[model samples]
Target: MDQCITEVKPIKGFYKLSMKQRMGFGAGDLAQNLIYQTVSMYLLIFYTNVYGISAASAGIMFLIVRIVDVIWDPVVGAFVDKNSPRMGKYRSYLLLGGIPLTGFAILCFWNGFSGSLTYAYITYIGLSMLYTLVNVPYGALNASLTRDTDEVTKLTSTRMFMANIGGLAVGYGVPLVVKYFSPDGKINSKDSAEAWFVTMLIYALVGLVLLFFCFSQTKERVIMDEKDTENVKVSDLWQEFKHNRPLRILAFFFITAFSMMAIGNSAGSYYMIYNVNAPDMLPYFMALGSIPAFIFMPLIPAIKRAIGKKQMFYVFLGIAILGMIMLYVISTNEALKGNTWLVLSAQFIKSTGVIVATGYMWALVPEVISYGEYKTGKRISGIVNALTGIFYKAGMALGGIVPGLVLAYVAFDKDNVATQSDMAEKGILWLVAVIPAILLLLAMYVISKYELDDATIDKINREIESRVNY
Candidate 1:
């Protein structure tokens, strides 16, 4: 292997990016978006409706899976950075981890398992572990692609755009597809569970194809020095976490962002079915949650340039908060009744804010990656990703746990295929309206503290390269 040359050049206003790099990096996100959306949006409903698992049990599984992520993420991160794999450090996992992920995901939806608690545990836990292996490496791959701030921004935008494309497909298509498999209009325990089986098989196969595309399209460049293959230690993990300020900021942001999205996404089915009295319309409304990403994600880099990242955060997060408020008010009001349009409108507004804000946040990881290298002459992309991966999973865990607990506490009865009680209705509303709104507000505060803008990051990159070459 040839020694890679490293340097930094400054840019003004928007970061410049070539279309190939942008599209290449974006492909990975599309795959991840599908994988994540399947879990976030559809998995819970599958567990309750098809698998015959109680909501509370499913919620516990969600939490357990996250706990498993905490243990697994660092290991994957450390292992990737240390071993120089033949297919490239991160890209190999797309196929390696993805194969099992696809298989497990399909199995999770399989109705032939006789619906045991133990079977659910095995499939869900294995799938979650495989997802972590793929996800942590993919995250590190982003930072490994380039050091140019502007290129990173473009990469982030393009990646997020592709990701939302996957999101839209899952959000919009899954419900309709699930309905297609159902002999009856509604999915319930009595519906032979074949609908979920068929649905999972479709998503898992589609997801596998997308992952292959990601593997084919992307390549890693400007990664860590080959000589830096020192064994990644437990102490090094603590050191990185202790020293990296920007890493801390991104980590906290992930927690809040994932939690907000998770709670809302997880609770969506219940909200539509119970409160809105339109079980059939859940996909359309849930699709609204991701639809804005298609419209707003392409505009993110432009939006960041026009408003500055911090101000953009303030504006978009505020928009999301406002949308949450509107949802709370509308869901609470009897005059609105069961108007699907009003609910859809609220979902659109809320998603518009969330889609752009959260989608663009991935761009910040590379900046922090550069910052970590600048501060400590060691560019451990895997460890940086691992650190942040902890927070992302943490947020997702909270999202899953909170809703699972809430529904369980309210005594949510999945067997009642027609109508739910007032308590269950309140629980669903809280997940959709109150809980997510609070998390978004907290996200705003955490993101406010994110200090690295374009100038500082550019300066840090130059300073680090200079220090290394000198």
Candidate 2:
């Protein structure tokens, strides 16, 4: 085994990861999800319910923050690539960027200050920027960890598994924790703001702890070539954008898939509160979304091996759309009103498809990175990650903007104790079901355009290996 390890074909540089090393690489993702999921799942609710911001104002804020991401993500990516810190280029940011990320995330949910809009702008924008600071490097760190294709796949699966651990914690635990802190077990009641503050504070602190663990576990192995580092320019990003067709297809697929998940997840709080009239069930519904990750995530590699990646995408995405259609029809049907079991069942089914399909997409990033290196003799890992970061952030923006705008247009009232108006209920239903259904359909189309299959990536890796041997 040791001889085989030493005798394996080499690229410009090579790194081998033990199981412990691979699991450590994935710990970073767990830390990341804790912070990111806080914003993704709870921020909208915090805005409307706790801080008392109008949905329209929150929507505009979301769009502005995403636009700000346009400038910020590339800078973080490039900064990591150009400068190497003592701890390592990418992992250093976990401590530097993550501590503040934790603080800002907590602040975003705080209601101590009366300046809702100012608090919203400061905390949210800070959270977004700090998140990019940590996230971009973490992504770059993944590429730097190893060059082995199969190893990266295992690493991605492990990362996603740990990531879902964070997601599950946030999804399943937050509401229960919040309710415990609420004045009398009512999250939508007058004391809900206090509950939110308490819950976010705890989640943030726990997230910071995990960030430290991630920092302790991972290290950079396949460092970029120094001469190539000297030639690194942001303009090189555009060159890849122009020549890398698979990257473009992947970028669009990221947008569509993320948009689909975001739109659906964002609207979940509203759907349970208004349309279903069982606000307590929101956590269960949200938990349902992450549960599939546990079930299907472990099966991804085997599934991909059996059916192929492209076919796997077509299969899961089609199932996702069908689940959404079921949700829409059931939610909108008068006969199904008050049927909590039926509604939750549909959500569980819808999420099964969404979670597995989306979770597996992260594995493709390294493949595209390798493909770029094979084609151009340059491996700008930062640039590829930055581009995909933009699309994923865009999806998050749509998640924030669309539901807020739709609810605002339909006149959703945050202050109301009773159910929302009929029109608002319809809007929530559409947000949960129809809109995501459309986005999933588009995702199927975009993923179909992906040209790099396993065979192609394997071929590229072999060619690169052959060249290095001579």
Candidate 3:
């Protein structure tokens, strides 16, 4: 019986990844984040204050771009699963999508167009759509790597660590580089246009290099049978969502978590510059956003094993809420206001919780993919990831809408860059602290709905492998 079980392993892949393979896989997320995180963190402020568009216009454009993604993401997902590319099924996009993605990403930050709403719409929409091409494929690639749940956790940890490194680069390094290029050494002002363009050009080139490296490192192993591939349709994404209970729960969590992160990240620059009256502190504030990942992400496997995954999530998420509350108190209190150490401490705490909770969520992606396959014999990773992508964007849509509408409600004046009214400052505070904390509460509830725990997913995976071998 032991010999029979031992001989019954899948022929192609589902082996543990090498350290090199893990780093190479992680490099992909780091590369994408360099461009994507920059957009998430800075693009709105760039549009309103530097590029000459109104906050409301920029906000609406953000929404429109995401709406296009809602359509485009499913097509990309279905197309990827339906056909095998010559370069590779999923990794091919590292070259095919990365080149054009880099181009539009840099163009999104260019001031040459100078606030022309048409040009803004064209470039941004192009960037978001092409991003789907890379993002959908890349997401599917994670599931294709291996079937070992422990390996998935390590891979996700490494990926999030690299991702935060990219975030740090955008948060801290971009500003420093832009300052060097700015004649007056200011990143937020109109005159810093040349600086912004040059900085983006450099980052985009580096991202392109990382994407090529990622392409070389990754090899797709677990995929649908060729016969299964031909049958995949765009509608399969919806079908998979309806059938896979864990996937459905994970999808809602994506919306809530991404919405929470986006709202908070988008609000950071404005908070530091306006409410805190410390533009120079912006980079440091943002850098802290990713710093906690380095400190705590490595311990996640142990943490989950010790406390169990669900309990681990509850702890970190609860920590995040506590941090947000700390931020609100520090920012609003007269005695604590303008105390740099206190502000930075609160940010560190908030980020610590947010980073760990969100980072672990990616590991669950492969589990749900396994669950889908366990129920329906087809491991349609692309379609499943696409479903997650759409919901992820839905959350981001809220992120984009809330900040603009709130700022507009408070009558935030773009012309008055030097200072905003107290009402506008209060609105920025809500974006940074209160609203996000509310979403975090929703996330906790959504997580409670998730059904796949480690042992159950492992059993599902082993059963599927046994079927393949038989």
Top lDDT prediction, candidate number: 3
Ranking by lDDT: 3, 1, 2
Candidate 2's error at 231, in angstroms? 2.7
Weakest 10 consecutive residues of candidate 2 by summed lDDT = 4-13
Best by TM-score: 3
Model 3 lDDT tens row, 197-225: 99999999999999999999998878776
Q: Write the per-residue lDDT of candidate 2 for residues 1-470, one digit (tens) a residue.
A: 45544566545545567777767777778777877876787777667866778888888899899999988777766677777788887899989999989889888877887436877888889999999888888887887777676677778778888888888888878878888998878665557788888888888888788888878888776665656665766777778778888888898998988887777877887788788888788788888878878888878878888998899988998888888888887877789777988887887788778877888888888788778888887767777788889889998888879988998999999888568888998998899899999999899988988888777887886776565431
Backbone collision count in every prediction?
1, 0, 0
Ranking by TM-score: 3, 2, 1
Those runs of model 3 whose alpha carbons end farther than 4 Å from true positions after fitting are 1-13
RMSD of each: 4.3, 2.7, 2.9
Candidate 1 local lDDT, 114-225, one digit each (tens)? 5588888898889888888888889888877666777787788788888888888888887787778788856555584788777777777777787787788677765766
- When 1 and 2 are scored with lDDT, the better candidate is 1
Error of 1 at 417 (Å): 1.5
**What lDDT does candidate 1 reach at residue 275?**
89
**TM-score against truth, every candidate:** 0.94, 0.94, 0.97
